[model samples]
Target: MRKKRRYIIVMATCILCFFGIIYFIVPKILFYTQMYDNRINVAIKNATDIHDLLEEAIHCIEKRQYYSAIKLYQKVVQDYPYHKKTEGAQHAIGSCYEWAGNYKKAKEAYNIFMKKYPDSKLAEICRQHVVELDNPIYRKVNDAMVDKPEQLDKIIKKCQKIVNNSSGQKKTDAMLKMGECYFLKKEYLMAIEIYQEIISNYPDYSRIREVEQMIGVCQGLLGNYGKR
Candidate 1:
C-alpha cells in the first residue's frame, strides 16, 4: 500500500509538470509565431501600397495629368519614406516639374533628388538634368539656375523676396514657388503651411486649382493625408 501510494504521487507530479509546460511554453511558442506572421503581413501590405501608388503615378503621367501624378507620387514618398519605390517616385516629381515648363522649380527638384540620394543610380542622371537646366543656353530661355545643395537658403531667399514684393497673380505664383522651394528642401510641414496659406488668401487666384493640388501633395508628403 505504501509503494502504491508513492507511485500515485509521482504520477500526479509528472502530470502537473506536463500541464505547466503547456500553460507556459506552448502559449509562448504560439505567441511568437503569430507575432512573426503579423510582421510579415505588415511588410506585404507596405509593398503592395507602394507598388499601387507608383503604378497610379505612372498612369497619371501617361495621361498627362501631371498634377494628379505628382499628388500620387508624393503619397508614395510620405507613406513609405525609405521604401524601395520612394527613389523612383522622387525622380518622377523632378521630371514632372520640367515637363510642366517650371524650369527653376525643375532644377530645385532635380538638385534635391540628387542630394537626398547621392548614392543612388539616379544621382548621375539628376546631376545631368541640373547641369542642362543651369546651362547658359537654357538659362537664356527660362532664366533658371540650378540651386545646389549648398544654395537652398539662397533659393528660398529669392522666392521670399518675390513673395514680399509681388502683387496680384504674380504674388500668388510667388507664394506657390516659395512653397515649392520648401518642398524641395524636404521641409514638408513648412511647404504644407505655405500651400494652405495660398488656398486661404488667394481664393480668386487663377491657379487656385494648382495651388490646392500642391497643398494636397505637400500634406501627403508630410503624412497628413487625413487632412488631405
Candidate 2:
C-alpha cells in the first residue's frame, strides 16, 4: 500500500510538470516562430488600400524592420501600380535600404524609380542620391565622419564648397551635411541656421520634413542648454 501511494504521488507530480512545460515553454516557442510572419500577414490583410499599406510600411521602418517594410512597399508597387502614391512607396523602399546601410541596393532601387517615374518630383532627389552614394566625400560624411567628430570641421568645409559651386539638388544636400556637422559640434544655433537656409532656398526639397524636424530638435537642445 505504501509503495503504491508513493508511485501515485510521483506520477501526479510528473504529469503536472509536463503540463506546466507545455503551457509556458511551448507557447513561447510558437510565439517566436510566428512573430514576424504572423504580424506581417495580419498587417497586409488589414490594409485596404495603398495608403494603408504605405502607413504600415512607415511604421515598420520606425521599428527598424526594413525587410518587412520592403515587402509592404513592394505590395503597393505590385498591386496598385497606377495609384498616385505608388511612386512614393517605391521611393520609400530605396530610402529603407539606404537607412539600413545597404547603399548598393538603395542605389539600384533609386535608379529603377527614376527610370519608371522619369518626370516625378522625386526624380531629381533620386539623381542626387545616386550621385552621393557614388561620391567618396558623401560616403565619408555618412559612414564615418559623424562617428568621428574631429573630422566634422573638415567635412563642413567640403560641404560649404559644394554648396557654393552647386545649385538646386546638390546645394540642398550639401547644406544638410553642413547642418549635421554643426549639430555634432554642439553648435545648435549654427545647425538651425544652416537648416533654415535649406528651407528658404529649397522649399520643394524632398527632405524638407526631415530638415524641419532637425530644426525642432535643435531648438529643444537650445532650451535644455538654457536650463543647464
Largest TM-score belongs to which candidate?
A: 2
Which regions in candidate 2 have their CA more than 4 angstroms from the true location?
1-34, 144-171, 175-200, 204-228
What does candidate 2's lDDT look like per residue over 201-226, in tens digits?
78988878557656754664565321
TM-score per prediction, in order, is 0.43, 0.57
Residue pairs in candidate 2 whose N, alpha carbon or C atoms collide under 3 angstroms: none
Q: What is the lDDT of residue 103 in candidate 2?
A: 86
Superposed by TM-score, candidate 2 places the C-alpha of residue 71 at a distance from the truth, in angstroms, of 1.1
